[model samples]
Structures are given as structure tokens and as C-alpha cells.
Target chain A: MSYLKEFTKGLVKENPTLVTLLGMCPTLAITTMASNAIGMGAAATFVLICSNVAISLLKKFIPKQVRLPSYIVVIAGFVTLISLILQAFVPAVYDALGIYLPLITVNCIILGRAEMFASKNNVAASALDGAGMGIGFTLALLAVGSIREILGSGTWFGLPLIPEAAQEAIKPMTIFVLPAGGFFVLGCVIALVNKIANRKPPEATGCAACPNRESCISVEKAESTVENTKKEENK
Target chain B: MNKLFVESSPHIRSAWTTQKIMLNVIIALCPALVMSTYIFGIKALLLTVICCTSCVLFEFAFNKITKREDTISDLSAVVTGMLLAFNLPVDLPVYMAIIGCFVAIVIVKCLFGGIGQNFANPAITARIVLMMSFAGAMTKWTAPFAWKEGVDATVSATPLAAETLPSMTDMFLGFRAGCLGETCIAALLLGGLYLMFIGLIRPATPLCFIGTVAVLSFFYGGCDVNFMLYQLMSGGLILGAFFMATDYATTPLTTKGKIIFGVGCGLITFAIRQYASMPEGVSFSILVMNCLTPLIDRFTAPKALGTVKPKKEGKQ
Candidate 1:
């Protein structure tokens, strides 16, 4: 039950791509085509699972001060391995993914999992977490990629969905293949996911979790000073 | 028998309600609307009606679904629809125009908290989206009055994209191929002047925007006044400068900021037009500047009457 929970949580509750929003570079870049999305997802997932298990196994030996760099080296090694494998076997996807394939070395999802989950957890749990998160990221990419491909190219997985005659009448919007369309689709997908999950805005729990905590805290301080002056005047 | 009503500041109110302002904008747009109809025939008028109706319906539906207050009565959506129609090629399919309307009212406006809260001008953004989606259809311009040829209207490049330029008088009087609303300089100026007269929009942004383009094109064309005039009248420059660039919600508030925004728009437009593959850069430039409006407002915000800047202790 504990192992299953760790695996299932990443599919939805703690989805790295949709919820935590890690690995955005590839999510927005390689999702122009459904096939590219799957290829990229598989590559990233392989790296993620491998790196997670390796990090979890080696965590006791790695010093806390140098853990992050050590994790990067491990992740980079797996990323290179996957990149070479893809380049040798599936050159089409390799060419399509381009620089983004190598860029998986710096993907925040792998490092985030290593630091937050793998580094602290046992090998089994960390591997489960990695597999779950990897699958979640893949699913998210597939959703975004399918939408972009269908609308942008009037096709899915390179098979012509819209008939030729109809395509002439209602040509596919090429913009969906562009970077701007990636953002629009990503936003819509995220919104849909939030709605499906009935996700409410995260409750403010001090400044730690807030992204804009630095600027927000300063504003709060200024506001409090103004309020203090007002109270003094009233007194 | 005097009743005292206590409220915050801005105690004074004006008769310029959202509806009234929208109505005035609609009225100002009438000349260009009329010109497009005349140039493109009944198809232009049909497209406009479809766009306006769909925009209003989309907004109404979105509000109903979200359980928000009905905003359709404000007629802002109507203005957005009309502006969108104006930006489209007259020969575009009705369904595409409706998609543009959905993007304008729903995606760009309602999703961002509706009306006054949208980061970019809804019409401008929707037009760009449509342009990107249907590049072939969007760029397929019909020559003025070519609809008279019955369905097989002679397709022609817009003045900016043409190999040889049309006469200044022809371009000024709106005898050319371009988007429905962008062709006619005369009608657009009439609408712009009316908006300025009604005090709904200040001339600072439009003047600075057009002037910057004029100055840049003059030098770029090696001091040729004719080329400058041609550049000013061509594409969506006049239409965008007078109307979309002056959108209150997406534009800067202060005069200094408005000038900066306008000049920024002009610079981008000029660069794209002169160097870029695309002939028209008005929409892209306006969209870019619209995104920068918040920053412009922040930097140009008026200081409080009695507030003093904090002194740097170490420097002193």
C-alpha cells in the first residue's frame, strides 16, 4: 500500500509537469508533434527512473554539501546514455527533438526528484516515485502534443486525420505548431487539469511557499508601517 | 433634510458610462465600416455583423457559465468584434471570424478576468492568432471592388507588399488591397478625429506613433517624403495607431508613458516592415507594446503630492 501510494501520487496529486511545473523547456518545445512528445517523454522517463534509483542508492555516500552537483552528474550520465540510444535507433525522433534531447541533462524534474524524493527515500520508493512522475510527465506532454498536432497540422501521429478536400476548406492553424500556440495549449491544459481535480488556490502559509514572497513580504512591511502610523495618529 | 453619504474618494462621477464610451467608439468606427463595405461590398458588412454577434454571444455565454455578472450590456464586446472584423481580410470564411471572436472575448478577455483586466487588446491579439492559424486565408487580400467580378475576385498584394506602389491619392482614398478596415486612410482619420473630439482618447499616442513611423521611414527611404507618406498610409499603421494602440486598458495611463509606448510600437513596426518577411508589422508591434504597458505604467506612475524619496545613507 505504501509503495502503491508513492507511485500513484505522482500520476495526479503530485504530477511533476502539470502540478509542480518542472521540465517546462521540453514540455513547451517538443510538444509540437505527438510523436516527438512521446519520444521525448520516454527518454526523460528512462533517465528519471535510472537517476532516481542511482541517487537513492548512493545518497548515504554523497556529502550533503555536494549532493546537488553529484545528482547532476548522475542525471547527465543517464541523459547522455538515452541521447545516444535514441540517436542510434530512432534518428527521426532524435532529429526532431534536436537540442532538447541533450537539454534533458538540465531538466529540473530529474534533479527535483533526486533532491526532494530520491535523496531522502529508499531505493524502491524513489524508483516508484520516478516511474510515476515520468509517466505523469509523459501523459501531460502527450495531451499538449496531441492537441497541437491535431489543430496545427490537421493530423495525429503523422496520420492525416482531416481529409484532403476538407483540409483545403478548413486549413489547420499553423500557429499551433509555433511556440506561442504551445503556451496557449499548455495554459488551457493546466486549467483543465485544475478544474478536473477541483484544485483550489493554495492557502497562504506564511512566505515560504509563495513564489513572490520576497517582494510580497516587503509590501506587507510597508503596509504595516503605514497602518502603525495611522494607529499612532488615532491614539 | 440633507442626507450625508460617506464614501471613499472619486466622489464625482461622469456621464461617460462603459456603454456610452463603447457607443461612441462604435460611432467613430462607422466611417471605416462604411468605407470597407463600399470597398469590399456587402461581404465586409456581413463579416462585421457576424463578428459582432458572435463576440456578444461568446461573452454572454462565458458570463453565464462562470456565474459572473452579465457584461454584454456594456457593448465592449461589440467594439472588439467590429475591430476584429476590420482587421480581417474581407473574403475570410464566416467560421474563421467566429473563431477569432471566441479567441477575443473568451480566451483573451474573459479568461484574463474580462474587459478592463486583459493584458493585451482583445481584438489585436485575436487578429494575430487568426493570422498565425490561417496564414494562407489571412494573407489572401481581394482588390478593392473586385467582388463585383462575382466570386472570382482578383487577388492582389496589399500596398505594402506590392512591387509598384499605388498613387498617393488612391492609397489615401482607400483604393487598394488590404484588410477591411486598414485600407482607407480618409475614413480612419475621420473616426480618429471624432474620438479625439469626444475626449475618449488623447492624440499623444497616435501622433507620436505615426510621427515616429513617418520619421523612421523618411530616413529609411533616404529622405523621400513620398515614400514616408506611402509608408504612413500603408498596411494597418493608420488604423492601429488611431484605434488599437490607444486602447485604454492595455495602454499606459500617463502621458509620458503613452508617448514611450507609441514610439516603441513605431520602432518595432518600422523594423518589421522594412526588414522582416511579413509586409505588415502593425499588429505584432501593437501586441508587443501592449505586453509592456504595465511596466510603462509602473515607471511613469505619478509620485504622491507630499511624498519624498528615501535618501541613500551610505552614498550621503
Candidate 2:
């Protein structure tokens, strides 16, 4: 049940793309088409899961100072493997994904999970976390891609949805396939997710999850000390 | 018995509330609206009506769904709709116009915390989005008064995109093919003059914006006055400078900031018109400058009274 929770959490509550906003380059670039989104998502997931497991297994062997470089080595190997497999069989998707497929080695979700989860957890839990995160990223990409595709191109997965006559009356907004449309759709999707989840903004939730919490607290303390000295002098 | 009143600062009351200001803006827009209707015929009026109605409806609906205070009474949405309609081609499909309204009122305005809080002018942004989305439809300008021939509207290029320009009088009177409200120099100037007269908008931004464009185009056209005037009169320059660029929310606050913002807009517009593929750049330039308004305001902020300037370390 705990493992399942780890997998389920990434789908909505801890979505890397929609919630945490990780790996935005691929999320914004390759999501013009639903097929490209799935291809990139699947490729990233493979790399993520493999790297997570491998990093978790080798965590004990790696020195703490050089763990990030060691993790990159693991991730690069998996990314290359996936790239070769896709190139060998699904050449069309390989071409469509192009540079983004190989670029997955440095995707923040994979590295983030590797650093934040795999290094600290056992292999099974790390693999589950990777899977959940990878799936979440894919689902978010898919949602954005589908919206852009349907509205921008008047099609779903290259199948014509708008009739020929209707197409003349109202041409599909080609901007949806453009980079601007990708941003618009992504923003709207994130807003929708936030609405559905009733999530508080990061500020309202406080500094517990903030990466800069310690530094921020120290700064606040320093400011208060200065203010205290000033008040004493004034008195 | 005498009545005594106690109050805080700002004891002076004025008749110019938000609704009254918006109403004044609508009244100012009437000249251009009337000119567009005269030039483009009934379709222009119909598009304006549809855009205004849809914009108000979208704002009302969005407010209801978000359970925020009712803001439709301010009439800002109607202004946005009218401005968006003015930006659009007269012959654009009704659905596309409605989509633009949705973008203006719902996405750009309400989603960003409503009217005064919007980062950019909703009408301008929506027009740009519509231009990008429906490029073919957005650019397909119909010749002025083509409907009066009792046949289908003949497609024609706007003055900016045309091979040979129309006579100055024709262009000035708005007998040229262009976006709904942009062709008429006379009507737009009339509206701009009214806004300035009523003190609804300061003259600094619009004057600087138009002046910059005029100066740049003059030099770029090899100091030809006719060419400079044509450049100034063409496209959405006058309409944008007076109405959209001077938007109170998106533009800078201080006089110095407004001047910088206006000059920035003019430079971008000049660059895009001279070098870029797009024939017109008023909307794009204004949008870019709108994003820089906060920075301009920050840099141009006035020092409060009695505040000493920081001493230079090296000089000290």
C-alpha cells in the first residue's frame, strides 16, 4: 500500500510537470503533438526508472561528494540505450522526438528523483518513485499535447476530427501547434489542476517545502536583530 | 445650528468614478466607431456589438464562477470588447471574434486578477493571439465600402501592406482598407483629443509614442515628410498610441517612466516595420513594452521627501 501510494502520488498530488513543474523544456517543446508527447514521455520514463534503480543500487558505493556525477553517468547510459532502441524500431517517433530523446539524460525529474529519492531510499522504493514521477510527467505532457493538438490542428493523433466543411468555416488555430499555444495550454492545465486539487499556493502553505527555507529564516532573523538594535537606540 | 464635517485626507469629492471613466472612454471611442461603421458598413457595427456583449457576459460568468465581487457594472469589459473589435478585421467570423473576447475578458483579464491588475492590455493581447491563431482570417482585409456594391466583399491589402498608397485625404478620412477602427486618422484624433481634454489620459505617453514613430520614420524614409506622415497614419499606430498604449494599468506610473515606455514602444515598432516580415508592429511593440512597465516604474520612482541620497563610497 505504501509503495502504491508512492506511485499514485505522482499522478496528481506530486505531479512533476503539473504540480512541481519539472522538465519544462520537453513539456513545452515536444508537446505540440500527442504522439511526440507520448514518445518523449515514454523515453524519459524508461531513462528515469532505469537510472533510479541503478542509482539506488549503487548509492552505497558512491562517495557523497561525487554522487551527482555518478548518477549522471547512470542516467546517460539508460538514455542512450532507450535512444538506440527507439531508433532501431520506431524510426518515425525517433525522428519526431529528435534531439529531445537524447536530451532526456539531464531531465530534472530523473535527476531530481535520483538525488531526492534514489540516493536515500532502497531500490524497490526508488523504482516505484521513479515510475510514479515518470508516469505523472507523461500524463501531464499528454494532457497538454492533446489540448494543443485538438485545438491547434483540429485533430487527435493525426486523425482529422473537424469535418472538411467545418474546417473551411473555422480553420483550426494553427497557433496551438506553435510555442505560444504550448505555453497557454500548459498554464491553463496547471490552473485546472490547482483548482481541482484545491491546492494552496506555495506562499500560503509556508516555508516547510521551500528549498530556501533555512536561508530565508536566517535572513529574517538577521533583519529582526538589526531592527531590535535600532529600536533600543531609538528608545 | 451649523453642520461640521470631519474627514481624513482626500476630502475633495469628484464625479469621475470608475464607471463614469469607462463611460467616457466609450463615448470617446464613438467617433472612430461611427467612422468604421460608415466605412465598413453594418458588419462593423454588428461585430462591435457582439464583441461588447460577449466580453461583458464572459466577465460576468467568470466572476460568478470564481465567486468574486460583481465587476461587470464597471463597464471596463465593454471597453475591452470594443477595443478588441476595433483591432479585428471587419469580415472575421463571429466565432473567432467571440474567441478573442473570451481571451480578452476571461484569460487575460479575469485570470490575472481582473481589470486594473492585468499585466498587459487585454484587447491588444487578444488581438495578437487571434492574429497568430487565425493568421489568414486576421489578415484578410476587405476593401472599404465593398459591401455597398451589393456583391461579396472584395479582399484588399491594408495601406501598410499595399503596393501603392491611397491619397492622403482618403486615408485621413478612413476610405482605406484596414482593421475596423484603425483606418480613420480624423476620427481617432478626435477621440484622442477628447480623452486628453477630459483629463482621462495624460498626453505624455501618446505624444511621445507618436512623436518617436514620426521621427524614426522620417529619417528612415530619407527625411521625406509625405512618407513619414503615411507611415504614421498607416497601421494601428494612432489607435494603439492613444487607446491601448496609454492603458492605465499596464503602462508606467511616473512621467519619466511613461516617456521611456513610449520611446521603447516606438523603437520596437520602427525596428519591426523596417526589418521584420510583419507589415505592422504596433500591437507587438506595445505588448513588449507593457511587460517592461514594472521595471520602468521601478527605475523611475521618485525619492520620497526628506530622504538623503546615498553617499558614493569611493568619492567619500
- How many clashing pairs in candidate 2? 0
Q: Give the range where candidate 2 chain A is weakest over 10 consecutive residues by summed lDDT.
A: A210-219
Q: Give one digit per residue, the lDDT tens place, for model 1 in A130-174.
A: 999999999999999999999999899999998777876888889
lDDT at B222, model 2: 98
Tell me the DockQ of each model, to 2 decimals.
0.78, 0.77
In order, candidate lDDTs are 0.91, 0.90
Q: What is the interface RMSD of each candidate, in Å?
A: 0.6, 0.7
Q: After superposing candidate 2, which stretches have Cα over 4 Å from the reference?
A: A202-207, A210-235, B1-13, B310-316
RMSD to the hidden true structure, all candidates: 6.2, 5.7
- Indicate the residue-level lDDT of A20 in model 1: 76
- Per-prediction TM-score: 0.91, 0.91
TM-score of 1: 0.91
Residues B1-316 of candidate 2: C-alpha lDDT, one tens digit per residue: 4498453222458877779989999999999999999999999999999999999999999999999899999999999999999999999999999999999999889998887889999999999999999999999998998889865768999888799899999989999999999999999999999999999899999998999999999999999999999999999999999999988889998899999989999999999999999999999999999999989988998899999876768954
